[model samples]
Target: MFFMFIYYFLFSWNLAGVFGVDSVKSVSVTEGESVRLNSDLTEIQRDDEMTWKFNNIMIAKLKDSKSRFYEDNAEGRFRDRLKLNDQTGSLIITNTSTTDSGEYTVIGTSTDSTLNIFRLTVYANLSVPVISRDCSSSSSSSNCSLLCSAVNVGDVTLSWYKGNSLLSSISESNISISLSLPLEVEYQDKNSYSCVINNPIRNQITHLNITQLCHMCPDCFHCGSTEAVIRLALSVLVGVAAVAVMVYDIRSRSFQQKREQTSPSNNE
Candidate 1:
């Protein structure tokens, strides 16, 4: 079982890496908010220059010995909107919009042909969600599941909550806007749960309350009722037996007393 778990983990991780980067990376912004993306060079010498490319065009250039590339390119719908800090090799795109959705590739030259690559993804706002669930109302209490669903959402997550308190959560995938949470449901007392569906793709929430309305009580009607009746009958029977025994003892004692007082042999 443990080995199977390990293999499952590795396989899932591999699958995530393979299918994870499917969506255009999203960044949330107000009307004029700035965001940052850091591109690091791994196994590369410090004397290398890093370059940020948007749509195959050089957007910003980094000086050698500086890890950052600053843009500050606020031209053509980006007037004072783009800021690229070349020293840290990070990009700060300001005043972002939906049209800003495109390929952003950062390339760092290594000694070998191994170019350290960083993809800068950008996204904004949220999408209307199409959602679903995995665990049903009839599911057992041991392992319950609920899935919130959507489309075209990259890097989203699903959080299960009972009221304000978080019950459980599951990470979202690239292809799917769905969130799956495997949880232990309380058999009786729990109810009215919701799944907050959110990630870099969109922000929305879905809910699954325990639809089966239950009055909180252990049922004592049938079996307990029978037991009470049986106990009452047994108590009545014991009372009658005790009364008969007491009456017999009293009658015997009285008869003995009468015989002693009226002493026929002694009188004769």
Candidate 2:
């Protein structure tokens, strides 16, 4: 073990990475997706701290001070949206769109050497994930299920969030339905349950799902089918138009023959 350690120390990729690209090679980011970056900042020296530059402009300084998070020069548009997670060397931008997309670089320096430079592309999304009412099946009898949640969320409570607002309590430890607890009101709004999850260190989000017993096989709880009705109406209108055109053509031809006969043009 000791010889292997010595061999690794003398001729290992660790030493080689100090001169080459130790981080991301190339990454593709969708218009509003994430690009994960995992790296170590400890190799940086005190005087040789890294600086994040966007399009040739300095945005932030790395690990210089507790309060001195990221270079303070982040572009005006990205003020509150650019999240620099120091723990994981992760960079996150929310609500990605096309204009926010660009080339970003991390320039790290050592005692006297520039270790490596990593580059990434960023994108923006104007719209967030819509909390549509999904009525999928779940193991719980409450077909009132929510799904398509964000993956890799750390330890966080699940609850409802509406348009950047917390709609309910994070902890659902003792939620109970009681007989005296306004059963009428509950019946009126019993169809939807919002699923929320959040952690203190990171952002929280809520996705909505829907109503009870959507599966009772049509025992009179009929969810309206707007599309089917529209199609039916359209079909009837087309049929009426066809009949009207046929009648109009026949009447016009008959009227023309009668007029010719009366004018003596058809007598010969």
Candidate 3:
């Protein structure tokens, strides 16, 4: 084992002249998109050899003007999605996902070895914000609380706004960040509030109209159960009184008819 380590150490030092790139570059892209990791080489020479690796694992190679990809070396998430250009030695990854984020290195060998490093970051798109109001305390409308929430977002920020003024903001770096922020404000007819979710590549928002939310309150119907019951009782009494008056009028007419018929016999 000691002899093997020494052999590898000597071999790496000898190849050091061919792989000279050590600088790191950062690139960010939204999920489900495409990104190109450029080699910064316009063309490859006839004697030049190029290799692309992910985290030091060789995934692709260019030899004698031909491009080759080793399926066993590619990560499962990147398999079948990696494309290499034979001329320039750049790599294109299609339909990238969060798991595809990592460091990629390209080594080119011709007269001298050149190395290019890329740190790729894949972020999921920001989700739309959902805004809701809590008005449980009926004492006053000025103490209502508004909540703004977003889920399954990445490299993004969530913020609250009242017209042109800012209320609160939160940011996260996780690939699937989820959070909520609350704003307490007085409800008014002309009050306007909004929630914003945004990243470098995309933006989402939701609006809250205070007047509309207030109209959803129970008291907004303008009447309670007691008032409805009183009105119903008055209608019933009016209906009963009309029925009694009609019965009395019918009885008086019947009695008058009978009295007239009996008096006619006296004339005979």
lDDT of each: 0.55, 0.45, 0.76
Which parts of model 1 are misplaced by more than 4 Å? 1-33, 41-49, 63-78, 108-115, 127-190, 193-202, 206-268
Ranking by TM-score: 3, 1, 2
How do the residues 1-268 of candidate 2 rate in per-residue lDDT, one tens digit apiece?
Answer: 9999998887777767655556445554545564544344544333445555556565555564221334345446556555655543345556554455455556554443333354554422112223432332222232222332333222334445444554554332222411110001122243344444444323334334333322332432222234544666899999999999999999999998889888855666
Question: lDDT score, residue 234, model 3?
Answer: 93
Model 3's alpha-carbon lDDT is 0.76
Q: Each candidate: RMSD to true structure?
A: 17.5, 18.4, 9.9
TM-score of 2: 0.32
- Model 1 weakest 10-residue run by lDDT: 214-223
**C-alpha positional error of residue 170 in candidate 3 after TM-score superposition, expressed in Å:** 2.3
Model 3: lDDT of residue 116: 86
- In candidate 3, list every pair of residues with a backbone clash: 18-113, 21-115
Error of 1 at 225 (Å): 38
Q: Give residue 250's error in model 2 in angstroms.
A: 19
